[model samples]
Target: MRTYNIHEAKTHLSRLIEQALKGEGFLIAKAGKPLVKVTALGKPEASSTRRLGFMAGRMRVPDDFNRIGADEVRKLFEDDA
Candidate 1:
């Protein structure tokens, strides 16, 4: 698209924002008519692989989840007194 008019987008604003962060989007006129369309903002992409179960069955894992607090933690280390 490459338009850049306002004084060549203020003298090539940092190489047109590094070519619009590499996706190459452009258009910023003011006297030639366009207006603004710099681009580059959709960034949600950082998964690096870590989806073991992702909540498999959605919920429910109580097989005494490690002995549901085993007898009040064995009576707080019993010494009964």
Candidate 2:
């Protein structure tokens, strides 16, 4: 880390940026108090691509899964006289 007064920072802005890109950071000060820290912004992370049926073989469905509750489900909705 390095410290620079306002004038020095302004005079050597380009050099400071180059240093920052190389992973060196510095602080800029006004009246001997640090005003801000200068550093490079890191590259963004890559996003993963989406695929359909990504969990196709990860789980199994029982043979009677769909018809297991058919009759009770119909009685709940039908009116009883």
Candidate 3:
């Protein structure tokens, strides 16, 4: 691991990112105090925006989904099992 001051980090940001993508991570600091880390993301960022409930109509729910195991679970919690 290597530490770079804020100015140096900004100047060499591109090269540092290349190194990070190659699995060599580093830190950026200000006034000798470490501030942030630079590392490779696990996957490429998605360009297309995603809307909430994208799978809303693609999945199914059972009729008993909300009531699954309600009886025995409640008994165990109340120490009455």
Best by lDDT: 3
Ten contiguous residues with the weakest lDDT in model 1:
41-50
Provide the overall lDDT of each model, using Cα atoms, as 2-decimal numbers.
Answer: 0.85, 0.91, 0.92
lDDT of 2 by residue, 5-45 (tens): 99999999999999999999999999999999999988765
Query: Which digits, one per residue and each the tens of the lDDT, describe model 1 over residues 1-74?
Result: 77879897898799898888889989898979997888887776666455887788999998879999889889
Roughly what TM-score does model 3 have, to 2 decimal places?
Answer: 0.53
Please give the TM-score that candidate 1 achieves against the real structure: 0.29
Number of backbone collisions per candidate, in order?
0, 0, 0
Clashing pairs in 1: none
Q: In model 3, where do residues sit more than 4 Å from their true spots? A: 44-81
lDDT agreement of model 2 with the native: 0.91
